[model samples]
Target chain A: MKMKQALLTLTATAGLLAALPAAAQFQKPEDAVKYRKAAFTVMATHFSRIGAMAQGRASFDGAAAAANAEIVADLAKLPFAGFVEGTSGTEKGSPKANVWSERAKFDAGAKKMQDEVAKLAVAAKANNLDQLKAAFGSAAQTCKACHDDFRNP
Target chain B: MKMKQALLTLTATAGLLAALPAAAQFQKPEDAVKYRKAAFTVMATHFSRIGAMAQGRASFDGAAAAANAEIVADLAKLPFAGFVEGTSGTEKGSPKANVWSERAKFDAGAKKMQDEVAKLAVAAKANNLDQLKAAFGSAAQTCKACHDDFRNP
Candidate 1:
């Protein structure tokens, strides 16, 4: 009976591990921090380009908007994998500890942002400024929501 | 005749601009530098994961290798655009001035790396360890060649 219980426990542990995101292994915790920041930086740069067009800060070039949106969508799936344990910071603008403590909510936020960004990509390709603006607004809200909830002020 | 010369000059300038890589605009030179560095950091992290598997330091996982390779290939197209004017540094490991001065050669090097990385992505999907290693070797060589020539010692 003890052996059977051990087997069942092992199976459960394996299932949990499989259920976790495919987090990339890091040589050090600092490496994970750097990677996540880098991913966010690149994603933000492209996303901001779309924001510029959406807000009329820059002229709306449909091709440029679509390209930037595609990049933003591709990158939306990356940074969360780097939110490894014990990597949170107390500094202003850093990821808060609750990212791990409230893992489910954090993940849900990430999924929400990714979904909105994907829609933004589709809207951008339509070559309509109004469609791009609407999608960008939705995606931007997802970003703000996650930041407000998960990041340090 | 002078009017015709002005028009010809304008056309040639447009052709030159068109021949250049599709670089993403940045608000400042520092922003361009940061963007490129972020891109390289992310690409390097993913590439190192495949390197670990290729070198037998990590157990080979075909799906993980393929995923990393795809990220690397996508990123290989990015950093070159950030090599904007006035961003070179004198520090060791910084991009050298020749990256701009020797523009044709630098662009060629970027193209070579991108091509090799694309092949690496395909090889990684083959689920054959030998093929992955071979492709990784070629891709690594391209990276090394660029670093040796265009990066400061």
Candidate 2:
């Protein structure tokens, strides 16, 4: 069982790394860290715009929701590339060490979020408030799940 | 002539503001500043990847160049939204006062950059290194023009 689990982890890690553009894209570990954080910041800003409409805090504009959702989906593919090895931090809101140790699980979470956001993008384009709300909830849950599992509190 | 230029600045500022999603997207001036900086950082990262290929510092990968150029084009529409009122700074690399004081000229520069990047995206899709290089040089010049005119030294 231990050997099988280790093999699975290796496969998962390789798959995740293969999805990245190139290690050369980031010349230093710090660059990777900064890139990932900036990606998250931009993604979150757009995501929150959708959240505002879904929660009734802001008026529902289908065009705006669709635009924001599209940006979110595009950005979803980005931050994972920045999760280079040895860059996990102990600070609050930072990725925990398990991001590397349990690399497969972390990669799974990233994939889940991306999948949810992609769905959210499609749903937002439907121009129905109910559909946007449902999709936003699912996507937000995926974000929380990863933060709970892999990020420091 | 001074009055004519003032009217033009007001018209340009209004047009630019109208293009943004809404002023309510940002809760505070700092948020706008941070959001814009994050957008620029992500855009520059992708832009630099293309630059590497264009300058022959890295191997020319047509597909990669196309992907980077597309991201740059999409991002060209974003950072300008973050240039809210009273956010200009005097520090090096910050937006100069002229960004707001000479709003029309600044907006023109922004549009020029967007146009160049859009062309770069199309050129990159041709998958010809020469075409990519030519488009990349034009796009880079737009970036520099804005930086030279609107950004502080």
Model 2 regions more than 4 Å off: A1-21, B1-18
For model 2, how big is the CA root-mean-square deviation?
7.2
List iRMS (one decimal) for every candidate. 2.9, 2.1
Task: Compute the lDDT of residue B26 as modeled in candidate 2.
Answer: 95
Per-residue accuracy of model 1 over B41-143 as CA lDDT, tens digit each:
9999999999999999999988878878888998888887788888899898899999989988999999999999999999999999999999999999999
- Which residue pairs show collisions in model 1? none
Question: Which is the leading candidate under lDDT?
Answer: 2
Question: Candidate 2, B59: how far from true, in Å?
Answer: 0.6
Off by over 4 Å in 1: A1-24, B1-12, B19-24
Each model's total of backbone clashes: 0, 0
Residue-level lDDT of model 2, residues A53-114, one tens digit each, is: 99999999998898889889988998888898889999998999999899889989999999
TM-score for chain A, prediction 1? 0.85
Candidate 2 overall Cα lDDT vs. reference?
0.87
**Each model's C-alpha lDDT?**
0.86, 0.87
